[model samples]
Target: MAVVFVITLAMLTAATVISGSPVTLTLERAFPTNHGVELNQLRARDLLRHRRILQSSNGVVDFDVHGTFDPFQVGLYFTKVQLGTPPVEFYVQIDTGSDVLWVSCSSCTGCPQTSGLQIELNFFDSGRSSTSSLISCSDRRCNSGIQSSDATCSSQNNQCSYTFQYGDGSGTSGYYVSDTMHLDTIFEGSVATNSSAPVVFGCSNQQSGDLTKSDRAVDGIFGFGQQEMSVISQLSSQGIAPRVFSHCLRGDSTGGGVLVLGEIVEPNIVYTPLVPSQPHYNLNLQSISVNGQALQIDASVFATSNNNRGTIVDSGTTLAYLAEEAYDPFVNAITATIPQSVRTVVSRGNQCFLITSRLG
Candidate 1:
């Protein structure tokens, strides 16, 4: 459920050493300030996006995430990505909950021309980029994607293509292409240098649902997941950057934060063990405690398995969702802890309840 918590958003997902310099990109809040209706829609869509990823994901990749406690306002984050030899800038959603990086392409059906975020959206033209090459189905990455149910191809063209249908009915489909991903790497933890690497990403040819609308549109989604096709994994596989990345998000009036592809070594940092051998960043949740009181729910309900989905920390999701068993009890405890005097009113298209008082 949606709760007001945290100001600085930080997270680390997996770690490694980079012989070469790791890159840093400009990260900022993607939504406009004071747009209640649009913000609600954005959160609703992100929740559905994570649901689809958690349900369909077959493998797991490791990463670390750390965030300072603050009132996390209504906004999803994005990063600036430069692609092709000429380096066209695109604003892509920063999502750790899913894998693969994709962007709208030329001749895309239903892709929005304008964005409500007021960013100039540019489409990736594979034909225009001399370094761009269409990924074949026979490629190992395509096979890996196929095994994970992330890709497919027909005998006629042999092009590796993929599709995702979100829980909110939004969907995107495109083919894979190999091209240059430009970056500004930090050298020796001190110097900044320009560099580039070959990366495989999506070229969206179609879009549906909210994705086709301009209100919350973006160039594409940059996923930080545990898939072989993920850009972060690709970088880690090489000596360019580690699998881990860090960000400090601000939902304030002046919205900007850090999004860097490097290790975040903070003093006295505590690490939480991720649930072993499961796809998605599943956590071994033992129980839920509200204030000084614990909920009367069994811990087994939070368990993850081949068929049963468990609790996960999704960077893309604006709210936390519990399984059916733990949901009621947890909600009960939260309701009990909070004063009933605080009214919960439906706002922004009935997407969430606006609470007037702080629950401490």
Candidate 2:
């Protein structure tokens, strides 16, 4: 349900050591999935063996992997959410592609009421604050004029509804709503700051098939990418800079990804040159080269013509999917690298290599 940005790190480093502050946001509540029920019961060793470990090489954070959902070219992670006031936890996916953070609603149809994963934060129940509102169909932010396919948004009781289809055909659908979000900010070693920001999110009331019943243990996602409305946008509005996030995919919970608020941790890490592509808004991509060879693909493969900078460089996807032409060359190169003994031919005429052992 949540969209998370993931980065691989070889080791764990302190965020405060690299930056001035180390903010820790802890979730003490239980999730609605079976993993939530059994998380504490299992010993550390058992948990380590069963869970997909993620860490941040340069942050003071760690978390367990609830489950993995692969849709489209995106891979999503479901994790536990704990807020102090609610005393309950919910499962959420961490996404970096879009902005807005939301969870499943208690009143949502088919949503788990007793799963113990709902966010019970006081901000949600405060009589003083207006209930988080949903975006209307007439609103400009809502994608309109399209039939309710998995890619398009729909109108529900005047609110915009969303359906996200992953590359693997797995997706989630729900109504969008706004809510108050809080992040524990760390400043200069011992200084701590807390800020509340408004976030737009999807509260899926009903889900079916693998989506409704996932091993990931969460019902929603958190988008923190370069999109206009992502959590980073809110942070920028609050005057936080150098906002960067790093997640260690192969480490312990104590070693998690760092969501940098205002600056890059190291200048060298930022050395990767950013190339601009025209006609596409936020989509930024140079040619994709395999090993040392460059592949020819359509420029449209980066992003829609209207949103160029919107090009997403995602690590979650297991395979590098590009426009058909680009995919062809990459596949061809791989097949050429292997001998006939290790290659298998498929009915679609695609050849796959069977690896008997590690290449290294």
TM-score of each: 0.75, 0.56
lDDT of 1 by residue, 264-321 (tens): 4455657778887766888888888888677888877888878857878776665568
State the C-alpha lDDT per candidate: 0.73, 0.47
Show where candidate 2 strays beyond 4 Å.
Answer: 1-75, 78-88, 110-179, 191-200, 208-210, 225-228, 240-256, 273-284, 288-291, 295-304, 307-311, 315-318, 343-350
Give the number of colliding residue pairs in candidate 1: 16
Model 2 per-residue lDDT tens digits across residues 1-360: 545342333334333333666665444332334233332444443434422222223222223344333333124444554332322355566655444455665555444433332333211222233545666777544552133121234443676776666544555566665556544443332223344555555666555444454333355666655544455554555554334555434333322243334343443543443345421123356577766777666665664454332355553344455666567776777677676667475757765566787654
Return the TM-score for candidate 1, rounded to 2 decimals: 0.75
For model 1, the superposed segments whose C-alpha errors exceed 4 Å read 1-74, 191-193, 251-255, 344-360
Deviation (Å) of 161 in candidate 1? 0.8
- Residue 277, candidate 1: Cα error in Å is 1.9
Q: Any idea what lDDT model 1 has?
A: 0.73
